[model samples]
Target: MAQRGFWIPLSLILVFASFVSLWWPGPNYGTDFRGGTEVEVVFTKAVEAHTVRQTVESLGYQTPDVVQVQDVKSPSHFIIRVQEVSSVTDATKEQLKKALCLTTDAAAAVADEHACPSNARATEVTFSPGGDKISTRYDSTPDLEKIKEQVRSVGGINLRAAADNPQIVNQRDNHVEIQLQSKGDQLMDGLRDKLGADTVPAQPLKVEWVGPKAGKQLRDSARNSVAIAIVFIMLYLAFRFDLRFAPGVVVASVHDAMVIIGVFVVLRKEITVSTIAAVLTIVGYSMNDTVVIYDRIRENLSKHRGKSFWDIINMSVSETLSRTILTAGVTMLSMLAFFVWGTGVIRDFALAVVIGIVAGTYSSIYVAAPLTEWIDKRMTQRLGAKKKRPSGKRRAKAVTGKPAEAK
Candidate 1:
């Protein structure tokens, strides 16, 4: 209790390290918030990450990250990330117009002149609100099959029309909407085309993409949610105990959060949607640990009213230390299984929780307890100073919050 100042330096060092590590190279955001494409695939045979990286990079994609998934069923499973793919670019749309003889380049370029004819092409090609559904409007219906084939070949085979086939909104006006499957098809096609010898892109694959606007919204919402949570927790603590205890809990929670985040930043792990979930979960978990300590201290304060404030904090923390360790250890061990076999996102969540448990335990003692003690010390000094002040008309007026009628 007397040597609390010595321990404060350690906490400062940790915060400094975490802050520097977090902001230096910055965080690498995942597809959920970074507006990118992610593809998960399984290779037929065991392959190294670098080998797969080369294969994917050869498909005109520059330096796409390839990571091997730790799945028991498929040892060769891998995930790939591409910043953007299957974009409905203006160039692709223009070529679609040309191939349909809507432009001058159509007649020579397209093979079936009779079936396609002239003056027969889509008037407009527009993407849906979500940008996955593509609608093409034409003055008259051209050949659907040829249009599908030409659209597939254009813009480096990026856009894929789903097998569900194009749905015609208007037969007379030739308004058709095509569902966009994924850039994965093109990715798989490229992989199979390039790696037919290797036979990768093996069985089932999954892909997901988030638009930039949508991703930003998610990121902003996640921050707001975390902040709102902390505010509520602070209010709960204040009402539950007092201002002395509430600040410590809030500070400890924030410290745990920053340190855990610093950990991911140091590891260069992407802060995915799952990671955010883990963070929120950790806040509640850490708060629970702090509350346990605070509860114990509050109980002891009543039992030992004569004891000094620091002595009470020290005794309370010492009494609860073993319980904290045992509880945190069990929780971490449970998460260990998830770390061992869970997929990427699950593993991320598990890893975060594990780190947070350790951090929460430490902060509850060193950071939270000490902060409360310091606040108590300051408050006591103010009280003692007020007691020494001259008890005259000025003090009387100040104390009563009204003027003294006579002195």
Candidate 2:
């Protein structure tokens, strides 16, 4: 017989580890679940993640979760995640105005000052009104192209020349308008200040915000879905097999889920909708594995009637071992590829699958089979005790020393 002495201890340890991991820091929920903003920024030139983090942090905001958006066509892209803000604050607007305003000599042409900010070369420094729309004025005809390029560095989008133009002698003729989108644009000015005016402009490719209520709804839905799935699995197993087999299958499935979730908790990976989907998928996968082994055990029961229950189980597992390995191996390889090369949610989903697959395989072999065998043994013992009990008529016949009539 295979020695299972270590199985109980190992299972206990794993359960304890999972408990601790979940109780301490807990699983790290992503923007999808926790309610936050996700911004995808595409720069004209490649920027390092550390530099981005440093720049974002310097702007009086928490460091965002940053990941490089890897693609052959768009190599200079990054995705940053932070808490959501409803609108830009007045203080942030003022900072942006100061950063965009350039102090240049009255005689300096707009084209000459476009390359870099000349603090020492400037004869006068002026700023537009600090409001939703900011406009800058200059004595000479400002290079609209250069001004637009500069505005872009500070998250200024939809740039246009203001309607007001002065052709009067010794008066400013250039006026430019800037429109700001979100609070994130406030960082643009800070970034320009740090990276210099010559740096390539950063453009917002996508922005996603999840409200707290919406996040709560999503979390509740994810929980309900998982619970419903487990219930359905238990019902299906009980209907398909003997009641004795259902407990083991359900326990194994739950064990697989907990272990997979525990891994994410330990790793501090974000739990997104994709993660929930992966977990549910793993439940089905694990149930399938357990069912296959259970089917084999059932088939062997009549064929190996004289064999001990333990022997039968062992033989069944041995017979199906190759199939189990092949199936899990192929699936694991595919998930591994996704984990290694995939990006964003796809990568996280693959990671969850990888963990679930290992846990499921282990539970199927060690957890489900042993549990079924134990339950079957307890049931047999109970039935045997009942059968060994003498009936009331039998007891009376023995006391009276007379044989009972045959039924």
Candidate 3:
């Protein structure tokens, strides 16, 4: 009881951490989450973090939201995200390439490959036949020559070319669109091919948008899955042994989980999809460890005819100590490998597992088993069912108020 009391303060600290994270959300990268653009860049050379930002700024772009994505599967690659690149032109793309390319050979080779900007240019050229201005909207960035020829081909009896000057209103690194003198569908189609093969309406881009919706949904789902798993684990323990046997296992599993969550919150690690998956995985993992110790308690209760409950629990935990240590030790080594070498996305997850494995091992032996014994003893005392001493009926035969006969 005295030893268990020592954990109370630590447990309270972990609880407070969980509460803080619940109310005060932490930082999440990307303009999508915070309403900005996210530019992802892959690089081949080992580079400094600040240099990447400088490169982005040199290309007439703002300082990017940079993060090092370390992939254990492929350790050499890097992923850098730059937000707010809504308009990319060929010149801008060239500038970006020039800024990011580190190797002299790589930079020099791709330096000369500049294509005329393929973004669309649109302008109102003339009034429609009904005096309503007919606006020409192309689906793609049209070739300047093709656009001029198409304009001349449209002869001006009903449709007259009003403006021949092409201007880029919106630009992006990969795609652009131009306004035209006519609103006719045929003209829009003719302009589509010249806009290059990659242009699409902004609607498709919206479909590609990664923002609050996805992140929130992912966060909520991860939270719910952990909760449901714990509830079911408690229910199973209650059914198998007794509700009295459940609190210990549930508390221990929760302790492991809270520590993991608290560390992540403090460190400000991004809770990616992989991290969520890891949280769910650890729930099952830590619960399994607690259940093993609980199962031993059950076995000892049925097999040991007269041992006290606390004694039985203590013995069970002691007996399982070697197994728990061995399993957790091996697992910790593997998780350590993942943490050291894993990509940024999954690194936090691996660290969480490392924390969870240690916590789970402790709880199974110290928290869960001891708490089980504590609760069982208190319940027995309350019910007036303390283990009884043997009656003196047999002693009377030996005494007989005199010397007893030898067997």
Q: Tell me, by lDDT, which candidate is best.
A: 1
Cα deviation at 197, candidate 1, in Å, is: 6.5
Deviation in Å, model 2, residue 93 alpha carbon: 18
Displacement of the residue 29 alpha carbon in candidate 2, Å? 0.8
TM-score of each: 0.83, 0.70, 0.58
lDDT, each prediction? 0.78, 0.73, 0.56
lDDT tens digits, residue span 114-202, model 2: 45444212233333222334446554555544455555655434332344321122334444444444555555556668866556365
Cα lDDT of model 1 by residue, 1-407, tens digit: 66667867877887788888867878878878877678888888777888879988888786687878888898888889887645555676566555544544444535665645533465676765344566777655656676676566555533453564666877887778766546666677778787674766444478777777778998899888888888899999999999988989888888888878888998888898888888888899999999998999999999999999888999998999899889998998999999987888898889998898888888888899999988999999999999888577778788888877873
Give the local distance difference test score of model 1. Answer: 0.78
Badly placed stretches (over 4 Å) of model 2 are 45-50, 68-77, 88-180, 183-202, 390-407
List candidate 1 segments past 4 Å from native: 91-125, 129-132, 136-143, 146-163, 168-175, 202-204, 391-407
Cα RMSD for predicted model 1: 5.2
Error of 3 at 129 (Å): 37
Give the clash total for candidate 2: 1
